[model samples]
Target: MDRSQVEIEEQGLGANPYGLLLKALTLIPSWHYFLAFLILSLVFLYNFLEFHFLQDLFSGFRGHPVCFTYNPCSVIYDAVVSKCRVLRGRYCATPWLSSPHLQTVFLNFNGRPPVFSYRRQLFYTSDGGTIALDWLMKCDVSGGALHMNSSISRNETTPIMVVVPGLTSDSSSAYLKHLAFNTAKHGWNVVISNHRGLGGVSITSDCFYNAGWTEDVRVVINHLHKEYPKAPLFAVGTSIGANILVKYLGEDGENVPIAGAVAICSPWDLL
Candidate 1:
């Protein structure tokens, strides 16, 4: 072949696009590939150990909570046992979050909570401490006017649920936000009773909330009852807040202002 033909044939053979990639790959050490594979395997194994798919698949459905009251023939048992869907229905947990520990961890780490815009009311306590009450009123209530003096005409009698959050939790907590949003959606007015020194309000006095402190809860309920005298008032307390609420009910006895109360995950005893 002539010089031109030889040059053209050589260039064609040498111009292969994959040749550069093959050369670069050849430079990588063999142990690097093994290390990469080992890291990937470790990650996969850790994730597999963290979430148990087999156990969740079989034990996702749980029984309902037991009903307790003064009498079996009382209206509470009749309504709760027969009509209340939450009491009568099966407690089916999400299969992915079957374990209680796993559920708590997942909720803390990556919970997807509903969005809310609350009308904040800062209440000063007798000891000069501050409590933030985040109210999620009805849809018709104007956003700009949430004060006691505002024109709340027909909705004055609407039921109100005062939610007291767990220790170190506030209205911004995922669980409390979900509870408030869901309760408000059902035509009831919901308010998150942020603990003293919590919910972005600074502590003004020496008074601080502990696990068994019930004075804060008592004052909040009484204030809400006084402000909306016609409105039926209810309270829901979770975790440390539950302890406070139960103690308040016991302390106040029949004089408690709330029409009903619910305490979730209350501790058995406090020292």
Candidate 2:
């Protein structure tokens, strides 16, 4: 072989291009490899910290006690019972009565258009706090003058159903509207309890409500009970409202005034 041929053989270009590329990769700066290793190490540390320590800590404190006497297990038990399973002694009932009606009302204006009419009427609590409510009234032709917005009537014998909505919801919510419509079709009076700060009611106070806030509900129920002393009262609540209703019932113990209650999708743990 000549000198040029010997030089080309020494370079080994025709042997394997991938081998040459691998040799070049070894020559890469140490800083690049260090940075890659550092990124991998940080990712592993983050995952380890999150899964092993942070997750356990959060789980341990998931439902921290709100009151000294508050028993979370009781709340959980009530929630499970609210599901309406294990009828009598054994065997679950199909198509539970607590199931919410599947109907969606985007916006209901009663008789007026959305731009001109207000669906809910505001009322003041005993503590001077204000709350918005939607009423389903019954009519009578007797001498009694019925308030158009009140959820009571003079001659109607059907029981009243009060519905309390969850977070970020109001009387016009789909579930609330559906419940009202269904109960009304069943010849019953219905009312939707819109929490303070929601349902377009100007919140007069700076206080925000939580899962176990039942004072507002109690006040509303008291008003209804006084107004319709003979009629039965039933309450149904969803999500956070369900928790509040359950808590109220538990707190009341044997003195609960309402005939029956149904709670759906309640979160017993509020921490």
Report the number of the highest-lDDT candidate: 1
Top candidate by TM-score: 1
Q: State the lDDT of candidate 2 residue by residue for 13-61, as single tens digits.
A: 5678899899999999999999999999977866644323343345553
C-alpha lDDT (0 to 100) for residue 263 of candidate 2: 84
Instruction: List, residue by residue over 1-271, the lDDT tens digit for candidate 1.
Output: 8999999989967886798678888899999999999999977865765644554456544543555445777887777656657654555557667456788888877888876578888998888989999988766233523334433444499899999899899999988878887787677888899998889998899978998788888888889888888999999999999998989999999999889999999877666
* Candidate 1 local distance difference test against the native: 0.81
What is the overall TM-score of model 2 with all chains considered together? 0.54
Model 2, C-alpha of 228: deviation from truth (Å): 0.7
Q: Would you list the clashing residue pairs of candidate 1? A: none
Candidate 2: C-alpha lDDT = 0.68
Poorly placed runs, candidate 1 (over 4 Å): 1-74, 85-92, 140-155
Q: Provide TM-scores for the models.
A: 0.69, 0.54
Candidate 2 lDDT score at position 140: 21
